[model samples]
Target: MLYPNSSSFTPTPFTLNGIPGLEALHAWLSLPFCSMYVIAMVGNCGLMYLICREEALHQPMYFFLSVLSSTDLVLCSCTVPRMLFLFWFNLREIDFSTCLIQMFFVHTFTVMESEVLMLMALDRYVAICYPLRYSTILTNPVIVKAGLVTFLRGAVLVIPFTFLTKRLPFCQSHVIPHTYCDHMSVAKISCGNIKINTIYGLTVAILIGGFDIFCISASYTAILRAVMSLSSAEAQYKAFSTCTAHISAIVVSYVPAFFTIFTHRFGGHTIPHHVHIIIANVYLLLPPTVNPIIYGVKTKQIREVVVRLLGGKRGY
Candidate 1:
């Protein structure tokens, strides 16, 4: 509900439309969605296992990867099951509070993951720019603190927006067009003026996602400078090589997300709502699905551990 004047008709329960204008293709669409979901779960779980099992992998970088995997697991889980149900069975009735809860989780994990990426940039910064002090700087206690702080930031930022939907009384429509309950989609149904919510939500997104991008860029800049200062080109190449996976992970994570959000807001009525929904889901799904693959192929330590794990299982 989102208007200055409430409509005579009240929303009974919100419905998730599950990608507007794509009803006929739901069954076919489910194949790819389910495949990606399984891959995300298996890949992230496998990474988590490798990180936890290999004592040598117990470092600040892997610690951040652990957080990322956990966050991605939760992130995809928040939306995928419900989306599959919608695509397969067409069961879309979600109570108002349930919708709010979903929105909260989807947004919370998004911010949490964003913050973790920012922390990772910091990790690389310290490892490269201050190699001598890397261990001391990102020691166990400090790593734990970084994680706690990331969690607190996401919780504090997102918990309030969960209630923002409560302020809107939806007399217009209860059907959300996206695969999941999203803040703006939920607000758009309200008959009330949602400028405040819009502005505040935008502010929070920028503060979290935007700030992270800026800091990450700065950290990498310093890292490049540090790498360049190395005496030999081989040393410099190795140093830069170590950051390649992280840089790839960061780009994949943030760029599409930013593009999706931007197109959603500025693309105007010319773009179809279905396009918006797809982009939104892509933003949420792509990073988690892609991250482990990137690391598995790019990070030598993780690659070796996974190969060993698979080889040992083959032996059995």
Candidate 2:
């Protein structure tokens, strides 16, 4: 007759402390996100199809592009679908284990995307700066090695950080503020020691993200210097043209990522939650959506292939 039930109660589902205008804002935003996601998936899939079908584009550059499209596809799949679901259904409560998994893959693909961009930049540098040696230098084996290195680097670097995050205890409020489960946001809710996890997160930002950005910047600088030294205007123009798509993609990818990271680190509740949410969406979804469009529009060959594919379908 002693109260046994008092000691054995299950925890209630975690509810989100959504901001005042969050529902309205989320509703408004979901329309564009859904559109962007559809367009992004189509564009990326189309690029992959065109690249794989066209044997003429089976060189190192297009090979890298195919790989990039694949990565962007994965990156978009990781974050955008869940975000859309949360926006539409108001389903914010995530299982602890599932949240951790989402955080891990999101970080993994983000790092991999950065490495891919760096590789693309290096490929551009070689193609323009050393056209004679480009074929010899950027062989299949070399491209394979570059890809392997990128995969290994991203995989290895994120393990320690993710492991550190998993080890932390989350006995406190389990409600994560953000729409999707992110590392730092989830980490902040833990009741146990989080200093180590926070430090590890920062370490990852500096080591993996910062390092790749530095390398990409250096590669472009060298490419620009080499481009300037070339006497022929046509040659410089051609070389610069080759880089337009990549540069656009890089800016779209990096700027929002940096902004999101900076805001997460410094901005408090004083900053509008809507602003934070917008930045998060931009960081997660914009690159995938924009990259394919940039490449398709900037590269005439890709455009022609897409047009031909459409025309063939229409004729049939």
RMSD of each: 2.0, 4.5
- Put down candidate 1 lDDT per residue, 259-291, tens digits, no spaces: 766665677487787877887887888888999
- TM-score for each model: 0.95, 0.90
Report how far residue 200 has shifted in candidate 1, in Å. 0.5
> Model 2: which residue pairs collide?
none
Of the candidates shown, which would achieve the greatest lDDT relative to the real structure? 1
Tens-digit per-residue lDDT, 41-63, candidate 2:
99899889889999878889898
Model 1: ten consecutive residues of lowest lDDT:
1-10
Model 1 steric clash pairs: 1-168, 1-169, 1-170, 1-190, 2-190, 2-191, 2-192, 3-191, 3-192, 4-192
Top candidate when judged by TM-score against the true structure: 1
How many pairs of residues collide in model 2? 0
